[model samples]
Target: MVKEYILLIIGAVLVNNFVLSRILGICPFLGVSKRLDTAMGMGAAVIFVMTLSGFVTSWCDKYILVRYNLEYLRTIFFILVIAGLVQVVEVLLKRFSSTLYSALGIYLPLITTNCAVLGSAIICATEEEFMGRIFKSTVFCFASAVGFALALVLFSSVRERLELSKIPRSFQGPAIALVTAGILAMAFTGFAGLGS
Candidate 1:
């Protein structure tokens, strides 16, 4: 059991990373990664939302949705749970970290629609290995969110460096960023078989 859990963590955090590997949260990966600080803030917020939503969505799926044969509504129900969690995160950030709050701006609220969060929740709730197991699913979600944070932080650091380096005009701005992201994604694929 311990080994299985460890492998699961390795799988989620690297082999199946929601950001780099699975490519679920490209919006924030690109939008909030301009600054390391803001990227960290967004990563922390996503970790909180994804982890909590995993717990809530798992319980709901087991005790409510699956029990009542309402599995078809999983997407809608999961979105509602994730949205509420994002709101809570937003409120807390606004009250305590005005700087990060302001920096995040639209991207912060956009967490409500971040497919990575919703994808993690859905995976936790529906994956056969995680079904009826809230703890395992929550752990998976946390690992996945950590993976997202890892990718965001690394990418932001690269982007910060890119801001200084000279490049051809045609390769500047989003063009270069996309190329960097692709290379980063390729690098992540080196971990493809690690968990196995």
Candidate 2:
């Protein structure tokens, strides 16, 4: 059980990383990664939301979706849950943490609808091995979020450096980012056997 949990964490975080391996959330990977500050903010927001949504969706999948035969509604249900959760968090941040709210202002809303967020929930729920070993919902959520944060922050740093490099005319902006992401993803391939 211990080995299983450890492998699951390692696999999810690196081998099957949201950005590098799965290629999820590429929009923000390119868009928010232009600046370290915004990228860090976005990464933090993703970590919070993904972690929260993972636990919520995992519970829903276990207690509601599977039991009620609503597995077909996974996509819609996960999206709704994530959106509502982000909205609630955003509201609370607005009232109490104005600086945080502003830092996360638009990104929060964007992540609310981010397919990557929804995808992580759905994937985590379906992976019986992951669901079975994930004793605490909070741990599952936090692990997923941490993995996402790790990928985003790493990509952001790479992109920040790429900005100062001399690239070709054709591969200037998004193209360059995409190529860089591909290389990063390739590098992450080394982690494939880590947790298996």
* Highest-lDDT candidate: 1
What tens-digit string does per-residue lDDT give for candidate 1 at 1-196? 9999999999998889898878899988999899998898888778777787888889888999999999999999888877877788789889998987776665657688689988988888767899999999999999999999999999999999999999999999999999999999999999998967
Count clashing residue pairs in model 2. 0
lDDT of 1 at 81: 73
Choose the strongest candidate by TM-score: 1
Candidate 2 C-alpha error for residue 89, in Å: 1.5
Error of 1 at 147 (Å): 0.1
The total of clashing pairs for model 1 equals 0
Which residue pairs show collisions in model 1?
A: none
lDDT of 1: 0.88
Candidate 2, residues 1-196, lDDT tens digits: the string is 6876676677677777877777777788777887778877888888778878877788878888888888899899888888888888888999999998887768888888786787778777776655633355446556666777787788888888988999989999888888888888889898778745
